[model samples]
Target: MLDTVCGGGGVREAWGWWGRTLGGPVTGPDGAAWLRVAHSPVEKAGGKLWTGPEDAERLVPEPVPRPRLRLVRQWTDGGDAYKAELYDRVAGGTLASGPVLTDAPSLPVAWWSGLRAALGLLSAVRTERTAVRQAYLDRAMPKYLGFLDGGGPVPTTAPAWSTAHGDLHRANLVGPELGILDWEGWGSAPAGYDAALLHVYSLAVPETARRVRAELAAVLDSDAGRFAELVVVTELLQSAERGDNLALVPALRRRAGEVWRAFDGR
Candidate 1:
């Protein structure tokens, strides 16, 4: 399949959920392209984004100037059993060289610029549906509001909502040219939601977190942004209690404390 879509020289070097990714030099094309093959219905939210090129192109607006998807081919059998999308690959490397981050990382100016452009555009734009909703943010799953209530009233209300990238970690972004990969989660969410999520994820590296906070001060310092922080912290706390990403528990707790204090201890 890799050879068929990307020509013979292509190789399967990367992989994703329920599928594998192939990328290599495109013969006679003077460049490279990518292919993703997925099987059947991906019940997970945002699963459909990978199966159709039109969906991505329609949902993610042209925040061009930034490294993003340039669709080449999108084909499916019109059944829930098979789907695939081929995209023109970006020469720029991802935001982080590796998949995981534990230390303070340095990002180039292009990365910052691309991030600002893409996020700024999306933030102003709106989407009808988002995986992250008020219910998901304040879910009763491991309960954080109780603690914040200090044995008093714990309001389950949320703040103003806006468009969000849903997931915007280092792994999903590219650098040099600064490309933001993966648009499955792109939709309307809390205005400061994406920034808060990025900052929380960067908590393992204080310097990086500080850098994000400074660069996105307008979003992170506002009431909407602070509410978004609480949402992410609550989600992380639930995951920690569930024994997932336990290594990040300490950092998440610290982030939660900071968010709690910053949000008037709400």
Candidate 2:
């Protein structure tokens, strides 16, 4: 299907990183492009994940450093629905090899500055789409953060809200050039949500976590920022229950307590 769309473009490499998405680089007639294919049950194909990138392309501005989405094709086979998207190939590698950081990456100061600017610009864009729904927070926060000792009441309402790259993990962030990939969940979230998510993902490496805090302090230290940290911790704890990011569970719990103290104290 991709070959039919690419019109004889040679596939450079192909790999399935996420559960539902398969993507890699291809040398097309126009130039190098990334081809991503996602599959879903026919009944569930029209949901958010299926259409997020396309919506983001139409809604988000170009200066955000995300690759330009060029073409998309959708089709169904039996009970399965498939969609393919081709985007301009971005240069440089992800800040970390995967979603979680194990070591501190030596990023240029300019890269950090660029990230701050990109996130700020993104937050200013108006969008009706929501990344973190209040309903989910109302339901998930108490259920997950309930396990934390000394953790006070979980606040379902955010101090403020803004746009975010909902899943702002290391793997989605490319450095040396600063590109944010995986737009499957970009929309309105609690203010500082992106920075908080990045910090939590960097906890395994203390230096990296500290660097994230120091670099994104303006957002991470605010009332919304502290709340955002707990929000992220709640989500990670829930993910840990499903056996994902198991190693970070302890850190997430500890961080949840710390954030709650600051959140309640302030």
Candidate 3:
């Protein structure tokens, strides 16, 4: 399939890796491109996650430090559906080795400056598409926040709404170059949602987490940003219930309490 996508250019077999989705680097006549393919049940392949890259290409503006989508192909086999997306390859590696930051990364001053600018621009874009739905927030916040001490009853009302990358983790952040990847979930979310999500993912490394809060303070320190933190923490706690990021559960709970205290002070 990749050979067909690249018109016979070879995919780098030694560079391939997989997680929730599978992808690898490939060489085409024009240049090198990253080929990502996602598979889902046929009935489940019609929504946001399935069409995210194409939407990001059409909706997200340039100079945002993200790989541009070039081509997309979709096919169905029996009960399963597969979608392939080809994007311009980013040069530097991700900020962290994976979704969760396990160690502090030494990023340049320019990288932090670029990230702040990129997120500011992205948040200002007007879009009907939603990265974090109000309905999901309403449902998840009450249920997941209940898992934390004194987490229940934190209102889910967002002070403002803005475009977000949705999944702004270390793995999705390309560093030394400052490109954000995995646009599979970019759309309208609570203002400051991206910054809050990044801060949560960085919690495994205390210094990195502090850096995220400090670097993105314009958003992370706002009323909307504080609300966004609760939303992110709730989502992660829910994921933890499924045995994902279990290590971060304690930290997440502690943060929830701190945020709750801030709200109490208001």
Candidate 4:
């Protein structure tokens, strides 16, 4: 069992339970110590949570000199927020990537690697007993149909589907370790979902964004043009699912046209 070393005003009760479970020394981010027991991660249906199995399989943990740690507690009866052990605090950091993007020339390489990783996840899902492909198509097709009817360009036939990180972005990706967190929406999804998500988020940084798109296109080869359209459509669908925030809808629509035209060689 693990004890998260972080706590605040309302977290005391949760921490108490955590301490009781771990029955061992537990530290908080503030350096407060306690005792607790830990339990193995489990899956509960209809619960919008991503835990051990998904993370263990999808992510390749970067080697660290010391053990990577996290708070061993889940959202309990209290509220939605998690009470977790926090370790290896990096200082002097800001959440915003700023207007200027990092000179990550290897972003293409990372994109290629990520695509392969995404494909690997898809292969694993295919091996599972459940008909995962149909499940995704069921969800994906409706969105595509709606967008297409609304004059948005999108691929009707199935592209590729796989387990996706759903919200892959640079902020969620930590350096050196390449750790991805916030797995709330992790699940089986389309091949280009994560890559598209990352590309959208990286757009603020022109060079990084270009590198991501180019790399993805390069990897897909002749299919790159069609895949690029799929990427834009996926972003629009995801945005609509989150909330019908109309702010970026026009931009996405414009991009969809651009990608479709490019793919059709119009």
Q: Which candidate is the best by lDDT?
A: 2
Clashes by residue pair, model 1 = 40-81, 94-174, 95-174
- Give the better candidate number (1 or 3) by lDDT: 3
Model 2: residues with Cα > 4 Å off, grouped in runs: 1-18, 149-152
Model 3 pairs whose backbones collide? none
Model 3 vs truth, CA RMSD: 2.5
lDDT string, candidate 3, 143-171, tens digits: 88775455347687899999999988888
On the 0 to 100 scale, the lDDT of residue 254 in model 4 is 56
Local distance difference test scores for all models: 0.64, 0.87, 0.83, 0.45
Error of 4 at 108 (Å): 10
**Candidate 4 lDDT, 156-244, residue by residue in tens:** 54465555555555544544433454444566554555666666555445676677667665433334435534554554557577764
lDDT of 1 by residue, 1-266 (tens): 65665546536556553343433333234345555554444343135355333454666677633333444454554444444455567766666543235777677776786787778877766556564766765565237645653534433466677777777777776666667666665677767888888888888777888899988888899878887887777777786677656777777767666666767744
Q: Which candidate number would show the highest TM-score if scored against the true structure?
A: 2
Choose 1 or 4, whichever is better by TM-score.
Answer: 1
Candidate 3 wrong stretches, greater than 4 Å: 1-20, 147-152
Candidate scoring better on TM-score of 3 and 4: 3
Q: How well does candidate 1 score on lDDT at residue 258?
A: 68
Ordered from best to worst TM-score, the candidate numbers read: 2, 3, 1, 4
lDDT (C-alpha) at residue 200 in model 2: 94
My TM-score estimates for the predictions, one after another, are 0.80, 0.93, 0.91, 0.54
Report how far residue 230 has shifted in candidate 1, in Å: 1.4
